[model samples]
Target: MSQTRSDLRTIQPSARIALLSDIHGTSSDLDLSRLRARRLQQAIEAINGECPDAVLVAGDLTENGDREDLAGIRTRLDLLNAPWYAVPGNHDVGPKAGIADDQPTSIGTAAYEEVMGPSCYTATVGPVRITGLNTSLLGSGLPEESAQWRTVERDAEPLPGPFRILLLHYPLFADHEREEAGSYWSLDPEPRQRLMAAILRADHHLIVSGHLHRPFVREWRGRALIGAPAIAFGLPPNDRSVGWMRLTVGGDGRVTAEERPLAVADEVR
Candidate 1:
């Protein structure tokens, strides 16, 4: 459905952005270091060459919130000609699976803020207003989840902009427009409904996220759901497209996004 060209420079862009996700920069198992680092480095170099206005990372900057891993990824991101921003993914600060339903999360929220700034925030890139959400708190029962939702409700209000883009790690639905809340691919029932309602209430044009590690796009009502593929690895036949999404927002609020494959020689870990 996309009329794509070979490079970003070929298009006349008022403001260009590179959206990257799921780099999974480090592994506790030392054996996988070279593989992960090589792919991430390639993606970073590719983004720098594009000379976009900004680079937005959808999350999973590291494997399991490793301080060293976050440091490595942040160092490489510093090389980009443009500023880079991000939100947290499940991998970066998600609570462990066995935590009780009523308990708070001992996840890496502090580390994330200390290492990557706020887990959620808003920024305007030219004509586009980007609102980032930390979906890692979906079912965690953490008090931060409630506070975040309140903040998001406030932040998602319509602003004077051409595009109101929302960035989160998880998709509202893993499969289709009508899917139920508790699908294995997205947030649980309560948070799912709450988040969906919030987005629909807001004046939003698009939603971009990364977590499934696969590239897919869908449209519901008037908004577009754009997903980015993983850079560190792929999910076999489903996620063969290892790349980032490039977007161009014009002065009139018109926006277009295209997927650009990475320049790495290897496609799998």
Candidate 2:
């Protein structure tokens, strides 16, 4: 038994995965949407140039969760030739702590599903398995306002694969692990702990997340954790340029992630 392919297509056992997160629905964090869109376009072209089998977005597709952000995001994503996957961040879902005037995150789960496919789903690329989970909960103890959890859980079972990957909006560990503020709001810490247990139990290669709008990577418990920066906004105090991550998964199933900035001069949307 050669044991080659997986569920979706022929399992080649290795594939390149370009990871993008926290776009925030704008062309750029700078002014003038023209150059910003151009930089974003350039980044996508570069990713495709690497011959990756697929692209992944961890979350925060729009700024302020506005409907218009979809337009810019769609434009950038359309330029990609390979298949891609994405989920909503806290911003795209409206107010994270509910509305200022008592509004909810909206039960438009179906709408998100239709617009960007399933809110929480799984995709098989050759021998690698990529699964996206929705971590933006409405209430403190809630899972999501929808059944997206069931979908992710159903498809999240570990497969005997070359690489197992999980795409989530929130960091898996507790926010207290890093900073005091809720910078990692996308990760409902409680549910994430459970999800982390599941992934560790299954022995995955890595878990990727965004929403902090800062690119970071670390390894723990034999799991590689990767996070991408905001493609639209820069962090407070305006230190360095914002960027995305390019992941190269080798034939031996090892992955190397690089975070590159979309630094085009005077660009913003």
Candidate 3:
């Protein structure tokens, strides 16, 4: 029996994925409104030029999680040549622990979903199975956090694919694969260990995360952990260049990833 075109695609030997993170689109409340979204436009153009099979945004699509900001970003992303998926970031989901007193979070689960649907979901592209985790729910203590955990459990079921990738907003840890989980820049302790255990159990191949605004990569427990840089602003003392990461899944279940930086004269943004 001849396989259908769709079936052939499902069994394709390779897939190219573009990972974009921390767009932080323009907001009146935010300074450098010109810098973030404008820089993101350049990244999107480059990704379109590459013509990847799919694009996954690690999160922080908006500076303030404003509906208007999200809508604008949606339009910009619609211009991309490939289908894209995303999880919610701390900014997108709202409320930072240390800054909660002065700058309260504006978007909770409802607001985030109103624009982007469920914060967590499983998507299949070619031979790859990608699961997006809503790391924003990690320490929120909101009712939705429990709901997200349930969703994670349900989606953790192994799918038929050589390449399985998990997309997250916060890095499992800021530095070192064996560091303590709670470091003010990663998933809260309990959730981090829980998710880490799930990935190890599922034998997931890769984990891509953003939020530190710096790029990094490490191999831990037989899985690849990639920290995607921000298209908006990067912390100092690092490259601080605006960029994204590329992941290629090969036929034998092998995966390779590389960081691609946008040509920027100034890394301040």
Predicted model with the maximum TM-score: 3
Supply the global lDDT for candidate 1: 0.72
Q: Report the lDDT tens digits of candidate 1 across residue range 206-234.
A: 78888888877676555667778887766
Query: How does each model score on lDDT?
Result: 0.72, 0.64, 0.74
lDDT of residue 46 for candidate 3: 90
Residue 64 of model 2, lDDT score: 54
Candidate 2 lDDT tens digits, 1-269: 01112123223456778888776555344453554466567778877787678888878776555445565677679889888888777666643442242334545444455566667766777767777766665234344544655555565566665477888777765334433334435444445565666776555677888877777677666567777776666565364567777876666555678776776565333
Error of 3 at 226 (Å): 0.8
Residue 137 CA displacement from its true place in model 2, Å: 2.5
lDDT of 3 at 170: 83
lDDT of 3 at 258: 76
| Candidate 3: regions farther than 4 A off | 1-12, 29-31, 95-107, 177-182, 237-239, 265-269
Stronger candidate by lDDT (2 vs 3): 3
Top candidate by lDDT: 3
